[model samples]
Structure formats: C-alpha cells, structure tokens
Target: MTNSRPVVNKPEIDFSDPDWKRHFQEDFDKQFSLPHLRDILAIKPRPTTFSLKSRIPLDDGDGAATGSWNGYVNDDDRALLKVIKFASPTSAGAECIDPDCSWVEQWVHRAGPRKQIYFEPREVKAGIVTCGGLCPGLNDVIRQIVLTLEKYGVKNIVGIPYGYRGFSDEGLSEVPLSRKVVQNINLAGGSFLGVSRGGPSTSDIVDNIQAKRIDMLFVLGGDGTHAGALAIHNECRTRKLKVSVVCVPKTIDNDILLMDKTFGFDTAVEEAQRVINSAYVEARSAYHGIGLVKLMGRSSGFIAMHASLSSGQIDICLIPEVPFNLEGPNGVLQHLEHLIKTKGNAVVCVAEGAGQDYLHKSNTTDASGNVVLSDIGVHIQQQVHVH
Candidate 1:
C-alpha cells in the first residue's frame, strides 16, 4: 500500500493583487464565525444581569448588579490568533503562502459575558450535560457554568447526569442546580454530573429537551460529544423550537482547533512530569537501564511533548505529529542502542496514539464511537525486551 502524501493543489493567485487582502479577510471570517440568534430567530435580547464585579466573597449573592463591571464583550470583539505557525521541511507554510511570510491579522470571536442575552434569564430553564471521559477540571467548569448562569439571574438550572444518557435513559433524572449547590463542587475532581460515552439518538435527545422544557443547554465534552451537541442544535432548529445550545469544550488531549489551550491540558502535563521523573529514577538506578513512559493523547501529543520538555529527563519523546520507525539501521531501536552504549541508561516517553500506522488497523470502536487504539506502549516495551 502506498503511503504517499496527498498533493494539495491550491488555486494560485498573484500575491501582489490588492484584492487578496479582502479575499483572505472574508475567508478567515467565514471560517471562525459563530452563528448568532439573529441567524435563526429574530429574538430581541434582554439586558444581562451578569454585572457582579464587586462582591469579594462571591456567595453573598444579594442586591443589584454593580453595573460598573468595566466591560462586557460586544459581539464584534475578536481575539487575535495567538499560536505560531509550526512549519517543517515538508510544511514550509511561509515559503508556500507568501514570499514575504507576513500574515494578515487573524481574529476569532472573543469569549466572555455579553451585555444582552437572547434568552430571558428568569424565564429560561437551562440544562447542563457533561459527556465522554472525565477530565481534571470538569467539576470546576460545571461550577463556573452554574455560577455564571446564576449571575445572569437564571432561576431554573438542572444538571443532566452521566452525559447525554440522562436525556433518554429510562431511570435517570435531572439534578436541580444553583450557585449554592455547586459552590464547593470544584473541590472535587471528575465531573460533578458524572459522564458516559454514547447515548440515545439526537432525535431522542431533542425530544427529551422538549419534554423537559429546557430553553438553554450547555454541553461539555470533547469532539464526539460536540458533534452530538451540533446534531441536537440542528434538530431543535428543524423543529422550530426556541432552544440555544452552547458547548464548553473539554479534553485533556489538547486537540481542539482554534483554541490556545483547553482546561485539562496544563494539569495533564504537570501530572505527566511526575511520572517521567519516576521513569528517569527507575532507569538511572539499573545497569544499562531503560524506562519507558506511555502517556495519554488520543489525538494530539501536547501532554507528551510538554511533559518531556518540562521534565528535562526524557532522552526521547515520541508523538503522533512526527513519524518514527521501530526497526531499521536508523530506527528507534538503533537510537536506544546508541543511548545504552553512551549514556548507560535512557528514558523514553511516548504518546498512546503515536506510531499507529505501523499497527494492524482495527474497525472496533468504544461506546463513544472512538476507535479502539492498539496498545503501542506494550508493543514498544516488547520490542525493547527483544532488542
């Protein structure tokens, strides 16, 4: 089978053309744009009561909003794209895109509290669901959402237990939520509402939303869960139902696009550093020893890369972004041998999703429809033993 890289035949235009700027700006805006309520329904917004800036101790929850809350983000506010373009020998972005390599200012809609909200705070019944696997800051995220909604004067807020399963599960029920209820929930790790994988169909979920009379829904999860939220949004729109679906993305893998970083990424990297240190100690203690640390990164290698960089003890770090071979004159096995001969010991860190191309492909998937990854860590360990 051929593993040749597919050629991207980009339609070329003169870089000096004055219209290129306009074209680029339009394309960029289209890519990062979010749909507003006006796009679907012509609902007039109500002034938000999220003006709580002065209360030093947040639980005081009394009296009128200070209104002096310096700024409320307007719909037109945009955040400049902060991440640098990562180019390599194969991906020479600057050389290919422009001879000057200068980029036009890239902006995305800034996230924060808005002065006017589409839903009437008191009349709105909000539902929150945390889906997929647990992450480090799920409870904190839930607590913040509840607190923010309370600040907006929302009276009816409920948690959908165990991800989307609560939507159609025969026995599951919604848990009433409030600022007081979720005040200390952040002290705990994992999701306060718990989480599950795949659940009932989107149609079934929307049906439950209608039955529960939920006007606003906050969905927290990774890619698959976000896809489900999008489906729910479309289903609600198709039925001409007045429902707003907001997704607060969550994942430890740091795989989300157009985002600087996700909530759980820093924590994951910090935890992985400790593990790498342990591996280093273990390897250093033995003669010609090798310590292999396998980390979790289902899609991206942020944890493995950051942890290795932070620990400074890892001799080699393997990630999905860069390719490596297990066997050859210039393969990983050769490098390990070189390290053993020179350094007497080595510490290697690998991301779980790395080196999947070498494995036999599987059609099996987990409950969330995520592909069941072959154990690359165990394979590397076995190869090390044999070598």
Candidate 2:
C-alpha cells in the first residue's frame, strides 16, 4: 500500500545559525555595491517647463477680454472695517454685560487697498506641512498650493514629511515639491508627504524654518495643528524671523468655529449613506432586526446629522450634541423596540462620541491632547444585544 501522508521538505541549512547570517551579510554587501544595483534604486527628479524668472502677471487685462468680474471690486466703496470689540456678559444668553448698553450698527469700509502684497513673487520659499488625521482633499490642497506658488514664480518649495515632527527629526528630510511633481497628485486621496499626530517644540520648528530659509509656511490641519502653528509663529516673531504662517482648516467633522463646511465632510456623508443603506437592507430582511451604523465625530454631530439626513432610511439618529437615555420609557432602546414592533425592523445612526454618559470615561489622552473617547458604538451594540 502507498503512503497517504504528504511528504514535507526540510531545508539543507538552518537560517538561525551564525554561518547563515554571515553568508547573508556577504551576499547583501556584494549585491548593494554593484553599479547596476545602485542605478536601479536611484530616483530621477521630475522635469518642469516653467522657470523662476518667468512671471505671470496678475493684472494682464485678461479679465476685461474674457468679460470676467475681476475689477468689479474697484468700483465699490473702499473703506476698512474696524475690528469688533466685545465686553464680557454678566449672565449667559445676554448679548452685553452692561444692562444699559446701546447697540450700534456701524459698517466700516476699507479706506485703502484691500489686498496687501507681502512677499515678492520669485523670492518666496514656501513650505507645506500636514498634521493630524487623514482627509479626502489633502492632496488636492497640496497640489493647489504648489501650482499657485509656481504661478507666482516661486521655485523653492519643499514639503515637510510627517507633520511637525519633521522639524526636529534627526535628518530633517523634506521632499522637493514643484508644479511637475504635484500636477497629478490631486487625482489621489490623502497627503503625499504623510501625516502624524503630536509635534515638536515651537523653537525646533522655528529653527528648522530659519535653517531652510522658508519664507512662507502653510500648515494643513484642524484646531490642534493650528494651535501649534500659532505657537511656532509667535516664536518666530520673538526671534525677529520673517516668516508668514498660514493655516488651512481640515476637519471632516465640520466643527471649525468660523467655517461653514470642511473639504471631506461631503465625501464622508456620501460614504456613510451607503453603509446606512446596507444596514437598512439587513434590518428589513429580518424580523424585528435592528441595524446600527456609527460615524466619525468627536465633539460635534455634523457628520452624523448630515449622514442621517442623506440616508433617509434611519429611524433613529444620535449625536454627541444631545444626550439620550438608554433604558427609560422615552429612551433609545424603548423607542427602537416600539419601532421594531410597528415596522418589523429599525435602523439607527450614531456618531462615535454619542452616548458618552453611558460609558466609563478613561483617564487617557491621545498625542494631540484630546481626551480619549469611549467606543459608544460597541457599548450600544452590547446593550442592544442584551435587551
């Protein structure tokens, strides 16, 4: 009778032996020293048609030829508005602290040129650094910055790799960014230079800026990143370094104070809508089944609200802005049970920061100094399963 067991092959040599290590090192050294190997690993720099000396005139009179709205602002009254000064209110919901305060509606206009020309075109050496979480249009924004700088005849542009940490890194390596390199980067998502949480000291960043001779620094991130940038700018000012720091707000939650919307918010909502649709289908297929979909939102409910509205199939929506009970008569669980009884199924959408009151808060924080949020989604899942 033939043997039915499978035959196994054994190695002739043991890789754990010191002889194997020596042999591997010898082979590696020999292969790496070859000229053909070095040539294969070398990266070629991208070519560009534009030169630093080439100037693209801002006022080329193309707006008049194209019948565009370029010089329309010149026709308006040019007066600068005075900054608004607010006094502290004694009570909440009061507009002013003084009871006898008089309201005045003064619309101050610009008295001089609205746009101030700061940096010269060709002399500008721009640096871009992206920090924090991934956003959809990061690459698009990077591409636009590079293209705009190139248009202004600014040839020296470098992208700092891996957030503020790049400033204090041992080698302090930065990628050379130009119109040619960033032309097709917008076709992809996320940042090409990469991103990370936490940052180096403000002095370190300022030192790197001074060392690199970067006149313009563009920081792309949310609130935490902006705060760091502000510190860096202050340090630069203290040192009398001539550097212009600009921030581009990037948050998928759309929680930035003055901004109406963020770049990735719409994309996030659109993607969440698809997940809600799938969850709704699953819920409808079973008797009295409940489908729960959780979205990204820390302190705000913008993503949850927009996703729920766009989905239209969500029976219950919960967010961090509002607190909801889980066990009361009017609680979420009770409401979901009632809905299941009436409609035979239920679908719920929740933000990640929702129902924080129900979970145990951990005394921990992330690298960005944000308090670690409990997983409300898993908590809700466990509660639902138990009920």
Candidate 3:
C-alpha cells in the first residue's frame, strides 16, 4: 500500500538573508566569462622584424657599378628603381645576381615579389586621465574609446593613475589594457580610473601632458573643468605641441548650452522623479495633503520641470527662470487649494534656486552674486498644512 502523493525535500533555505559572498562570486564569474564579438575581429598578429631593408642590386655592362651607386659598391644607395634577387655565391665571384639574368632566373622567381611591405609594428600607448568632479558616463566613454582604439591597431593603451594629481604625486605608469581592462565598465557608475576633485590650472596640465608624452587628452567635468580644458588647449597651441585635446560634458546641472544633455542629468532627473512620485503617493494616502518636493536646480529649471512633468503627480512646477509669487490671487496657496479642492491630492515641484520666497520676502544669490530665489514648494506646502 503506497501513497500516490509525491515526497518533497524541504531543505531549510533562507532566501531572505543576503548572501554577499555567493552574489559576488556569481557576478564575478558572469563578468569575466562574458563573450564579445568585437574581441575576435580585433586580434591581429604584430610583425616581428619590420625594419629589414630590401636593396636592389644593379648590373654594369663591364662589371662596373653604374646608376646612383656610380662605380662604387659601398655607396649602396639606389636612385634608379630596379628589382633584383639574391643568388648563391659562386667560388669565382662575390656578387648578387640580378633576376633578369637567365642563369639564376629560376631562383629569383621563387624568391617572391621585390616590393616588400615592411611591418614596423610600433606599440602605441595611450592613457585616459580625468580631473575634477565625477561625471555619469566618463567610465563608459573611456571603455568605448579604449576598445575602439585597440581595433585601430593600437596595442598598448593605459589609464593614467588617478587624474592629473597622480601625474605629480604618484608619477605615471603605462596601464596595460586588454578587453579585461574595461570589462563590464559600460554599466558602471562614476569614473573607473578615478577622478580628482582638484582642478589643475592650464600650465600645470600642459606640463603634465608634455612630460607624459600624452598624445590625446580627454577632459570630463563641469564648467570649471571645461574652462580648464580650454586653457589646456590654448597652452598646447602656444607651445606648438601636437596634443589633441577634447572635452566631455559631465555635469548634472544641465547648464552647459553646447551639449544637448550631460551624463548625470538623466540619473538626477530619474532620482528626483522617483522621490517626487513617492512623496505624492504618501501625500495621497494621507487624503488631506499637499506635497512640496524641493529638487536640485541652481541655475536651470530642467531637472525640476522634467521630474514634475514625468511623474504626472505634481500639479505645479516652479523653476528658477520663472518667478513665483505666493501672495497674489493666483499665489502658491491658491494653487495648492485649487488642486486639493478639485483632485483631493496635490503635488508641487520646486527648484531649490527658484527666485525669492513664495511670499516675496528675501532674495537669493548665485556664485557670481546674481539674485536667485528660494524654493517655493515648501512655502506653499506650509501654507496648505500638508501632513
């Protein structure tokens, strides 16, 4: 008599507990073993002895050297272009036989073509050094550049240890890179080479670039970093060095006008939107509420406005460029009440530097002593008594 029910092995498994060691091992294995199609096509053999010179031997009518050698065997330089082949030394003569000669024509034809392609594989070494503040896609860009340059027959590209600071402090070292040097770095956050917070001036950066023989320099940072890059470009021009300089915009502020979007802005906006949505949900649950989400935007309304618009939970958005008045008939309090009386829940996004107080009291100041404004989200929320 057997029971038809299947027996289960109930082993005690604590899935709730964080197994960091297992997680790390799994991630490490996945990262190292990952396959890429680009790596296969990039593997090309480097030349061994590329400096061998192929000189053409000439035949004189009376065994006298003519042409550019001009009756001199040691002149060895050829002005007239001719192709010749080496023949086995005869006991009677010490001369290289010309291929046109029939006696050794068979041997010359077997020696292959006279035009030789010299494969002088000079190992190209490059490095990426970043300075001042962290940008979102610096590491990703570094990875792409290294991979792309390798495909361009560059064998030795390195990471400048630290930023410009390391060149002065720890000195410089050639960072050996393979596919392994920048593996899984595209998904990485922050600079993998690590950046310096110190903004090196023009002269110091140029000196470092020249001292290191840096062929190309990629500078990733905000306005100050961009200014530093510009200074470096100017200095390089003044010195007549062929240092190719480029700048990658890496600010979360989204204030750089030349670039459509900086790397960190998307991340910043995403985080702000998430927080605003969460706050809206919490405020909605309270049922008698209005929420004021103060977001970071010192000079631009991009972050505050984008977050508010994306969430669709915020009814009002106040930016730095647009002035907000909390005392008027269509004031901050009036907006909050309007949303609440109609929708029962109100969310407002306010830029941290949104111009004056909502009640129009004090004034804000930027680094350049320009008048900025206080965030109006909190002021409106306070007036509405949002719990």
Query: What are the RMSD figures for all models against the true structure?
Result: 4.7, 22.5, 28.0
Look at candidate 3 and tell me the lDDT of residue 352: 76
The candidate, 1 or 2, that scores higher on lDDT is 1
- TM-score of the candidate numbered 1? 0.89
Question: C-alpha displacement of 126 in model 2, angstroms?
Answer: 0.6
How would you encode candidate 2's per-residue C-alpha lDDT over 159-244 as one tens digit per residue? 99999988888875999999889989989888899999997788878988998999889999998998998898777767766677
- Which candidate leads the pack in lDDT? 1
Q: How many steric overlaps does candidate 1 have?
A: 0
Task: Single out the weakest 10-residue window by summed lDDT for candidate 2.
Answer: 1-10
Q: Score candidate 3 by TM-score against the native.
A: 0.58
Model 1 scores a C-alpha lDDT of: 0.83
lDDT of 2 at 286: 84
Clashes of each: 0, 7, 2
User: Residues 1-387, candidate 3, lDDT per residue (tens digit)?
Assistant: 110111122234223435633543354346434222223334333222211221211111122222243222221222211223324433223232222221211100111111221222133456677666566778788887776555444556767666666556655564666567797887878778887655345687688778877766666666666676777777787777655565666777687753457778888888898899888988798875767788877667788988888888888888877776675577776766777888888777888777544357546644323455554555655666642
How displaced is residue 215 in candidate 2, in Å?
0.9
Report the C-alpha lDDT of model 1 over 1-387, residue by residue, as the tens digit.
111122232366456787875776688699778866677787886566565464232332232334454566878999766334534325543322444444556678988877666776778899999999989999899998888777777889999999999998888999999888999999998888989999999999999999999999999999999999999998988888899899988889888876668889899999999999998999999999999999999767888998999999998899998899999998898899999999999999999999999887789999889999998888998899998
